[model samples]
Target: MNDTREDMANRVFLISGGTSGVGKAIATGLARLGAKVVIISRSADRGQAAVKEISEATGNSRVDWFAADLSLQSSIQEVANIYKRKYDQLHVLINASGAVYFKKELTAEGIDRMFAVNVLSHYLLTNRLLDILQESGPARVITVSGHPRFLKNPVINFDDIQMEYQYSAMRAISQSLFARTLFAFELANRLEGTGVTSNAFHPGRVKSNLGRNAPWYLRVATPLVNAFFKAECGIGVYLASAQEIEYANGMFFDEKKRIIAIHTQFEDGAGNRLWTLCEKLTSD
Candidate 1:
């Protein structure tokens, strides 16, 4: 994926969770290619720092950023509107913002933090920006899926979405896996021919601090977990650089060109159902 960005057709990319790790890696790479890149994160200082680093390294001042507390629907709306006014022609959206904690917690809006950040926020942001992406035509929507999907059963008790009964690290990971992946499939179906496509990527486990928000037990256990994994960043480039990036919508990808099986929760009906839930939940 190095330097193949010379002939890009005026693409503008919006990326969440861009302050560090995979997001920053991908953003810098894209900006180097002359692609307009926007990095989204929770802190304006962090987002701007990333933008400055990306711009300095790539020598492309086209890199920009928007800060939002994606865990809340209102912030999602605010940032999406800011993006619209900044970039009139949108081409790709990377829904990479995510958080996890050992204990279950709720956002200020009374939504579960894990579910809100990992699932609902992306759903709302993507749907809100659907029109700009459609207008950009041949746009791409890519999000990150953790390899934990294969290691765990991604089943959520829809009757108890708040996880009121049981809450654990494993439980939150499972629910996010199911909910977000299902949303990806449904989102693809919803905008199949509008010139926008949605897909998810599993950035191979890297030495990043994904478990930063987890409890001490997880913090002590992460090193053991990471031992079984490999480097992750290539997966980002693969998702961003695939030859058929436009038509390769609604698929799951790993580091290279390999396609992973969609989680068992991904049925056509489930996709639409999740989309409907998203719309109602985020409607002003």
Candidate 2:
């Protein structure tokens, strides 16, 4: 599973949230492999700084960045258009942008902040770029998921999807995780013969700014939690560049690259329901 510069040279990878956390780590890894890496960030200044840092750190000038607010469908569409116009090929698309909001809020589009970011954004962005992905045949769509243990009994309450009645930060976060994973699986099934594979993986407990919007206590505890769990980008890099799993789709892999069986709950039409819901939420 070793990727050489020669093997990765000129290969294109587009990563959402590439300015931080697992996204930045994977972007760096890909850049180091000699691939053309494009990352999406919400802030122009931060995106430029990240591009410079990753380029300098990896010594790969091919690293680049684009600014976009993933929580907004219009923003995602605009960025995707810009990306397609600038790049002719997209070898890999990594949906790694995520966040935790201590307070329940809605985006301008009237979607829950957490769900819009963690779930709908992935759906819209990926679908918007599907043509390019298929054109770049043998491409991959790698999504970021939480720990398998937390997802063992995944549930999506379509009735109260926005948690309009009773909203806890944890409930919102959990629902987003489940919905995104379902989207990944459902995407794989739909792209079965398109030569574009889709899979989800846990990036482990990576040291990240995921808790930046959380309560003071949780934000304060982030550093301590990160001290014990480092950002592990091996699986992300592997899934993006691995020759073995080039066609692996509808699968879930752990941080160690072990394929875990998808829970039966996900197979019972939930993926379809989630996909339909996303289609409605993100409809132009």
- Specify the highest-lDDT model's number: 2
Clash pairs of candidate 2? none
lDDT of each: 0.76, 0.89
lDDT of 1 by residue, 6-48 (tens): 6453778888887876677777777767787888888878887
What would the TM-scores of all predictions be?
0.88, 0.96
lDDT of 2 by residue, 1-284 (tens): 14446879868999999998999988988888889999999999889999999888878888889989999999999999999999999999999999888898999989988989999999999999999999998899999998899888888899888899999888888889998888899999899999999999998767798889877888899889878866658889999998989989999999989998864656488888888888887763
Candidate 1 achieves a global lDDT of 0.76
Candidate 1, residue 227: how far the Cα is off, in Å: 9.8
